[model samples]
Target: MRLVPLDIDRDLGLVHAWVTHPRSHFWGMQDAGPDRVRAEYRRIAENPHHHAWLGLDDDGTPLFLAETYDPAHSELAAHYPVRPGDLGMHVLVAPPTTPRSGVTSAVMRTVLDFCFADPRVERVVVEPDVRNAAIARKNAEAGFVEERQIELHDKVARLSFCTRGAYEMSTPHLSPAAIEHAHRRLIAKALAEFSHERLIEPVPDGDGYRFGELTFRARRFPLEHWVVDPHSLRGPLDALGFIAGLRETLGIPEKLLGTYLEEISATLAGAAWKHHHRRETAEELVHADFQAIEAAMTEGHPGFVANNGRIGFGLRDHEAYAPEAGRPVRLRWVAIRKSESLFVSARPEEDHYRDELGDETLDRFERKLRSEGLDPGDYRYLPVHPWQWEHKIAVTFAPDVARRAIVPLDAGLDRYRAQQSIRTFFNVDRPDRDYVKTAIAVQNMGFLRGLSPRYMRATPPINEWVAELVSGDDELRACGFGVLRERAAIGYTGDAYHRTGTSSAYTKMLAALWRESPVPMLAAGERLSTMASLLHRDRWGDALVTALIKASGQTPAGWVAAYLRAYLRPVVHCLLAHDLAFMPHGENLILVLENHVPRRVFMKDIGEEVAVMNDRPLPPAVARIRIDVTDEIKELALFTDVFDGFLRHLAGILDVDGVLPADEFWGLVRDCVRGHAADHPALAGRLDLFRPTFRHSCLNRLQLRDTLQMVDLTDQAGSLIFAGTLDNPIAS
Candidate 1:
């Protein structure tokens, strides 16, 4: 790789074409002519703090164009708290002349090296447009920390920095074995989830497994918990091949199958991208704080095999916005008229949002309202995912913006990190503030991942009921379990979708909720984590749960029992005592830890998920939790969701790691259930119905049947697809 000085005279034609091409939107020179290009480079040549260079390969073919500047003196200076030794950079790779697979990343790595080679530079900074997910992802891989977004003249740029130490140890080349490991891990999850979903039934064949009808055969020798070992895979370690083998058997429609394949492509790409991330030991990961550990996770859902299938995201959006990408985002806020919107709050009006929004932000919002000659009283602000605004709302919902019903407030101030659910963002900047769950019309997993305006009304009220129940009950308090309340919610009933009706994505497109953050509630020395973190295994084969056990310096069973004391007991309590069951999946539950021991849990993602299993009296406000699920299926809440869904996978992890044998682990679970029952004799009548054995619930079946709309938020439980039965592990 080589860097040649930009030639203003001779290089004008080639450089002009490069900068003004459709792909060079980041260059901010799409319409510039030769003269303008000359003026820009001439300006760069004249500036002391900035320099431009043309990068080349060994044979002298132009590869990329790069500019380096001092951030303290650049456009980004006012946005960030610029420190000494910070260098700014910009790069526009000449659109690939041929089918060069990794030329972009290769050129980026070389330029980053060139930028850091300067002895005086301690950190490298860059500001790419926030929507330019391609560069943002490349930046993330190269050890950049996304600070936030800053307005840079023409675009709202995502500000990021890479320290010398971070760049030195970050983004390693993936060995073939590492790639294979990722492939095998994700494939195993696919086998388990897809089979569980009943897309194709995998029957045990001797010591191995087989799926598909007689004509087409898909087979595997799966390990404990059906984790497909890459070596034991009967055919090529083929993700696409796996789908092809099942296409006929699963009865997948061609158009839907094609789209599903695109999502699968994104999922597989995520696995490949995980190669660049640091292969930290579970021990190292266990020590990091909540958001850090969250960002550290590479995989998505454990039970759903195609967990990382974010369909709407192109490769670039995957890098910038996917939770797995670990890049920070600055949310775009908008003001929609109150008459055309809805806002609900659990807390008192002034206390619910104003404290967090602050005078400055509120003033800015009010200013936006005033500029439109509208009263602040008639408008309620909603935060939007930047990608959704650009890719969907700006283009797809352009009429709403033009009508000034939804005003664009470019991204600034707060820095949010995407959680596993993708649309939900936790404010890492203000950890104590409410988590903003926004609407993005992105096809992820099986759903179009939009927050429904119709559903906004019940969120706060349901959360209030749960929080009050937890606070009031001595039994629940004893378990040390709490809830991360969704204090407020907002949604816009756009006129474009008014006549189209509520079922469409257009009605679901613009909505948000401010769920109470788990950060502020954390006690001193207590750290929080997603329960899903327990199932993650780093490339070195260290399970995160194992590291937590080690961190607590307790035996595996002891640690698990303590965990069950907090996590399981409350869930069971809610079931038996209140006829309530949360969705209770890993992503929906939070584990609060002290010294790596789970001390308590914070239940979240309420409203839609909190189901009433039995006939019960509920006030009109809280009645949304009540579902018509029958007695036979109610126990599946604990069985399918908790035992089979979460614990089954966790048990596999613990058993395989030799932390605790399967029987002992299940025995411990039995002990916890019995102990909880014994302690709650007053509720013996209600608890009598609870038991271990349960029907196996097929989760992916719902998605397989209808990928377009996975589950209706209204008829949440009515859509369940079931298979056979599995003996529950935690039988007393």
Candidate 2:
């Protein structure tokens, strides 16, 4: 294969046919005629940031369409943090006129080489529509790491990137040894996580713990930092079959079992995606930033086995929109009838959201509704995940649309970027606007990640209650903890015709909530970064943590102490003082920084993640925050979630990078908890309830047992699965 200029006039005839093929779903040219195709390519050729090319076979026939551009200059709208030397690209292989083998791969390889031929290009990025699994697989073959799904004008494209070094070392096949290693790693993770969840107990068989069967028939490495090392695994390594066999044992329903398996397969596929690339050393990722560190995050959550199980997403979907893809997306909007929908506002009246949707934008929406013979006042506008709107709503909720109960509208005005969770978006164009969390029915890591319509009614009050508590508590204010309230929530219950059933997806289909932006809360010299990004490393193995420590001129221990004061201290405070717990994982929390050093913490995703264990509540609006659970299970919100789930992994990185030692890491966390107790004497009794050492809680068990609906919203804590125990390093 070789590079050839894609002459718009000459190629338009053949390109149109290929793009219009039913299989070319992501190309978005189904309705385009010859002239339209020409105009599109011509625009690409005209733009300075973009170029159009064709891959030609040995016989000199064009095999595919390729477009390359500067990502910063593209319509991507900066959904991602644009770095220097980033290139954006897209390709559409000419439909196979006849049975052919390796043609697509060959075309991709050529396209890759062509892009890399430019000495200035550091990485090649592309966003194929999320449904294009074939192309996604091809991208992995070309050494691409799937970043996340981004929204473009027309489709939800999977964002991905490839480095010349990674692509040059890519292989088309995996050796048996590689497959064995991958399988063992998958099974090993499953064993540890599932067993921890109490879903399956592994018996001592020969040398190792066995679950469901003797495949416990494996054994080897000892625990490192109180966590299982997957590489030491050896035995029957069928992750899918293992989970399926445990269906009844795990006590999951059959309907969810199928979805569970699909998620597992997708997780395995993600491992396979990285299999072809030359693995980057932890030392390098420690130094890298943006896409570099994100790429190194091949392991999802260490506690979950099928961490990346985005089931509804095919390889293509995974490529385009997975949070890791780091693509910018513009959410689709719809006007839902006020009678069938609900909007709870935290700001006076609906001014918060009204100001967000500028008067000009609202005027446009009103004109659109009026033109359709509908009244704007009777509707509440909800932003829908572009993927959910395209794949589910257009067809599933067509009846409501026909009746004018749900009116499809244009994409929102501002360009928004996806946060770690694919459905939540931060407006890059208008950073001060409240962050919008929309419902996406696509099932990923336990349950369809849809914002619950039934739950949205109580969200504002829950957020307000927490925000009020944080503000009123002088100690919490002194600790610099901030809670970004979900200012407003809106969702449609659906009209009678569309009210077919209240399945998880249907009920969540048209819901959105706006979280207060941390931008407005930042101090004069402060900046914002997702706490998850602290774990980010630059391409050179430089730790953002190390960088922060250096910038602060603090010892590694002191930097950690500051971080704990901002993040971990508040978590401990919420639990001890108010019987409140926030999911303190990387993605859900944001850290305010002063010259890249920690300053304060912000907690988000209040509607679902925030929970109060006891039923001691007075306000009816905030009563929903309470969840029933045993005292033992309540510790998990801290022990497992904050410590084992988040800190353990971060410690591993700092330890492996030699920037911080493991012992000192655990010691720091212990000091933070102990300090909080010492400072707040009134809560001394409550603080004693949180032990340094506790049982190991399992997250993947719930996901494995049921990907469709892992936990009951009504009984969030009661749904927990627990097994065994861990010798907490923080134990005093």
Candidate 3:
């Protein structure tokens, strides 16, 4: 596509038709004739601050019209503060002769490129009419953030701005350059994580370490953490080749080797996609909104090399569903026969449904059910991921649909953005609404992300138990720590899969859970950020933690201690006080930031993740959380999951970013540990948090052994593959 200056004499007829069409009502020129359109363009062409261009294809046929102006000299300058390098733009695609998939977006991006082509333009400003929902989505895809709504002379307009960097990140063309960039980063991560897992040890070389065919400089940190310098990597730089070459040493089974490599390739592709998008610097992200930080996270799981397998997603699916894609999603609703489905909740089921779906939507659903000759009260409404409904349930459960056991309903009113955890979604349309976590049947990390029906029955009760425990504990309340309880869950069991009695992803499909949102819990002047953001580093190697510390007006040590008080203190209290431990990894927690410092942390992903290590008496419905394990292995909850899995990466990040030294970081962690023990004297010796050595639980090893079923959810400790031991960094 090429941009040609609008020719008044030649393109007058075309431009006049476009602006005068009923479909172009938003353009505010429906009454304009050819002469009027020509005069308008003539004035725009004559003005020094304004100009018009015609976007043409290779054949020189006009496809779109674009106008660019200096915002300082336009109507927008009056509404918002206009910066020196802000360029105003407007684009309209020619009314389609035949509809195309991405024609408007293509034209939109082209216009952006044309604006950014000039180095003088630092940011592009747009003011599309508020009612133009299609253009709003397009603007969001182009990385334009809405600043405010302004009442213009003609129409109420949404004022938005997009920087050059943002534009480039949003429309990252999947070119050779992007692929190469992705490969380099993935290779670095593979080398670092695999080496950390002790899958393939790299011995000391000249300035770096040497493995089979790779050489990279790495600064070894505590807990066997290897910070491999991405720039120092010297190897084939092929993700598949890297994984395939280490197949023997990694002990990947022959049958699963191909799938493992496919996961690696997919991870690389995802890395590239993330690498291309997210041009915001760490400093810029310090003040970004919750969803922005969620979308900006590049690393899926810091410990896992193939963190973003997303095996079932194609290019289009990635755009529509991937968290990093920053796309809003509407959950598809399905009605299932009450006999074949289980509904569990802390609140009354009807009240829960009424609050979530609204009375109007509930009535609509009931009407739809009655129209199909099915009684509404006999069925339960369950939220289904659009992808799962189309790809899995629509076909695989057709028999159930035929019997009116599973009936499809319209999508919900709220729009949600996929959380970093992939299966969970944050409600973007209404922040206070419950987060809907749905089963997708997509393979991510080591497991197929499907919610088990039997397990769903106990979810709400387990959450209730945990919430009660946390509330009753003084230490947790003092630290301002809480759980985002899984309030409700609904699971549908198809007749065919129910009879099989075999454990498989098929049986676990078509379930959804609603977890309480942390947004409502936040106080005024406080904001929410995913705990994962602390470990996030921008493309330029600036750490978000460092930026956050700077923003907080606190020293590095002060910031670390504050964060530990909010996060680590509560985690340790839970273990010592109740023998209760959660998967307290970064993504599982939401950090409440007050003036950019972590004030409190909300733990989420309850039910399926929280484990009670001690043999404690429990209610039958909540007993699923209790697990039997030897006393010695219990603190692995703290040592393995918290210390090794989470803080190890955070320590490395802060150390590498030069904000805080690793030794000092650990010293602070040790202080937190001692403080917790001091506060709870009777429970200090319950778990040996200060043990000199802890078993080195290898995550990749488990995945390598069985990619399909990595861990037995019932027997987590039995499923772990421990290689050796790591010297405890926080042991005193």
Question: Which one wins on lDDT?
Answer: 3
Compared with the true structure, model 1 gives a TM-score of 0.76
Ranking by TM-score: 3, 1, 2
Over 4 Å off, model 2:
1-188, 191-238, 241-257, 273-297, 348-350, 497-504, 533-553, 613-617, 628-636, 656-661, 689-695, 724-728
lDDT of 1 by residue, 167-247 (tens): 876634444655666666666667766665555567776666765421122332111245544445554566666776677
Predictions in order: lDDT: 0.77, 0.73, 0.87
Instruction: For each candidate, give its TM-score against the true structure.
Output: 0.76, 0.70, 0.80
Estimate candidate 2's alpha-carbon lDDT, on a 0 to 1 scale. Answer: 0.73
Off by over 4 Å in 1: 1-181, 194-224, 347-353, 685-692
* lDDT of each residue in 1-732, candidate 3, tens digit only: 679899889989999999898888899999998889999999999999999999995346789989999988988878988888899999988887843334676578678878888999999999999999999988997889998899989999999999988876674436577777778778888788888887777889998898878788889899988888887878777778878877888899999998888888888888777766556688878878899789888788888888899999887688779898777788999999999888888688899999898999999999999998889999899999899999999998889988889999999998899998788898887889999999988998888899988878999999999999998988899999999999999998766887788867888888999999988998999999999998898877788988999889999999999999999999988887888889999999999999999999999888889988877899999888888888767788888889998999999988888888999999999999998888789988888888899889999888899888899998888999888899999877
Q: Candidate 1, after superposition: displacement of residue 132 in Å?
A: 30
Give me the displacement of residue 217 in model 3, in angstroms: 1.7
